[model samples]
Target: MKALILVGGFGTRLRPLTLSVPKPLVDFANKPMILHQIEALKDVGVTEVVLAINYQPEVKASHSQISILQLRLCLLKKASFYFLQVMLNFLKEFETKLGIKITCSQETEPLGTAGPLALARDQLIDGSGDPFFVLNSDVISEYPFEELIQFHKSHGGEGTIMVTKVDEPSKYGVVVMEEETGKVERFVEKPKMFVGNKINAGIYLLNPSVLDRIQLRPTSIEKEVFPQIAADQRLFAMVLPGFWMDIGQPRDYITGLRLYLTSLRKKSPSKLSTGSHIVGNVLVHESAVIGEGCLLGPDVAIGPGCVVECGVRLSRCTVMRGVRIKKHACISNSIIGWHSTVGQWARVENMTILGEDVHVCDEIYSNGGVVLPHKEIKSSILKPEIVM
Candidate 1:
């Protein structure tokens, strides 16, 4: 089987992190974010994975915005080459790392979600009428793909969408599936009233023929394609049994990290750190140097080459690779990105997200701060703010 992974658009929700790299390339645990989805696809007899991307926008330039148009044209000329180079490197690394044949299907103009399928028509079409997998790149989940395929095959539908139950259905695109037949009846995107608990999980097993219905224009699959298919009674829903997280934003990325680690601890306990005072469900990479007398845990991930000094306390934080935490520092609900330095007697807490190569001087205290890359923070931040 083949798969198409949607990786288009600038990830605006995850700024600074997405500013430096694409959302798919952002590190989740120790691996690039999209590797999880690619690995899952590889497990289910999938060989080639096509990345559907929008390299340029479709809008025609207006004379009133000539400067903006000029800037965009310049960026469009350069950005595609840079993106292709990064894609090449990522493809090479992932092929070696995960052993999958990855390829790209770039769109000259921005194609909305669901439009990419029609845009990549020649690449995805097969005469044998086989089904293909389509997934959004931002989701991180314990994808029970084998079971999903089995369910789709038995359901006898043109499409089968993977759905998962959410507590707050109003905030997401809720899927209303008939309990008996498993057929999708309706979709409520951010509904004001109580609709249903199940929401679209951003994964789909789509028949190749489904592309025949889509046009080569900006279109939303959720709003356009899905509703029509549901009305035709050819769309079905398969509720996933395990965990799912949409890690498109910074806060959810941390939450997804916690969920992933929690799941790993159940099936693979050896993957987590093993040492003194390691409080709960922690994953310290093998190369990380954890000092004695440190209290870590309740969902903490210390990446490779990290050095934690004695008497340090960490909880619900991701300390990325090459970070050095000096003595008596405390961190909670934060992310210290790659190669950052937190000094002695420092305290970082309350959802602070520090990008790569940041420095926290000794005795500094940062609370709910968003520090960008390569910055040196020297003062205390009691409230949430961005430190450029």
Candidate 2:
């Protein structure tokens, strides 16, 4: 079956990082966010994928089979143009990483969730009236797609939404389903008071018939489309039995990385931890390096190609790929992004997020603030820089 991935959002919440790359391309557990979704869809026998893109057409082009092979890399000595050439080259080199046929549907204007379906309606549907899968690109899940499809077929419902129970019903649209028939009774979008625990999990197995109802305009499936269909008693709910994380906010994004890293450690224990001085639950990638006499762990993750200098101490922190932590530095409860460097004696704590290429100079203190990508923090005193 075919799948549609929505990738056109502005991603205003994940600023600085999103300023350079799209939200779907953001790194989680050393891999692009959307790649996880793509891999999951492929596991469920999805053959084709359509990317709804606007900001970065190059990302879509680089992943396509044709562009992956044919795109050429050109290098020049000029500093400004050299980086451009490198990007041009990689886009050419890594095509066809996954053999699925990828087609990107670009929107000239901002098209809402249902609007993209209307735009790609012709490509997504055939005369046979097959059910196509649609998933939000920003979420990470191990939900059983095959079982969800089976549940949809058995019920013979017009539309089946994959739902998961959440503790905070106020944060999501709570779905009330019939206990016996598995039919969707109704949905209330983020009710001020709690109504039910089941919330929409951002996964849907949609029927082709439902596409006929969505008009060619800016519309949301949750706010505009699904509720109307529920009045006709055609929508159904299928409970999922796996982990689901929506990487929308900063805290959830960091937690999602922890969830992914922790899962990897469980599957292959030998793959995560190695060397002495590192203790407790931790995930260290094969390419990462932990210096001698360094203390780490108790819920920590060192990503690929990271280097921890001698006498460094880290706890409950996630260090991304290409990071370099100098000697005697102490880091706790923080996420240091790719290629960042922490100078000796630097102290990072209290949920600090250091973006790509960030340099925290010696004896610096950062707390409760996000450092934007490519920024340098060298002051000895703590400063609260609020990102607008």
Q: lDDT of each structure?
A: 0.86, 0.75
Off by over 4 Å in 1: 57-81
> Mind giving the per-residue lDDT tens digits that candidate 2 earns over 127-175?
6677988888888867578898898998887888988888888987799
Report per-prediction Cα RMSD to one decimal. 2.5, 7.8
Over the stretch 261-310, how does candidate 1's per-residue lDDT look in tens digits? 98998888998876768877898888988888999998998888999999
Cα error of candidate 1 at position 206, Å: 0.5
Best model number under lDDT: 1
lDDT of 2: 0.75
Clashing pairs in 1: none
Give model 1's TM-score versus the native structure: 0.93
| Model 1 lDDT, full chain set | 0.86
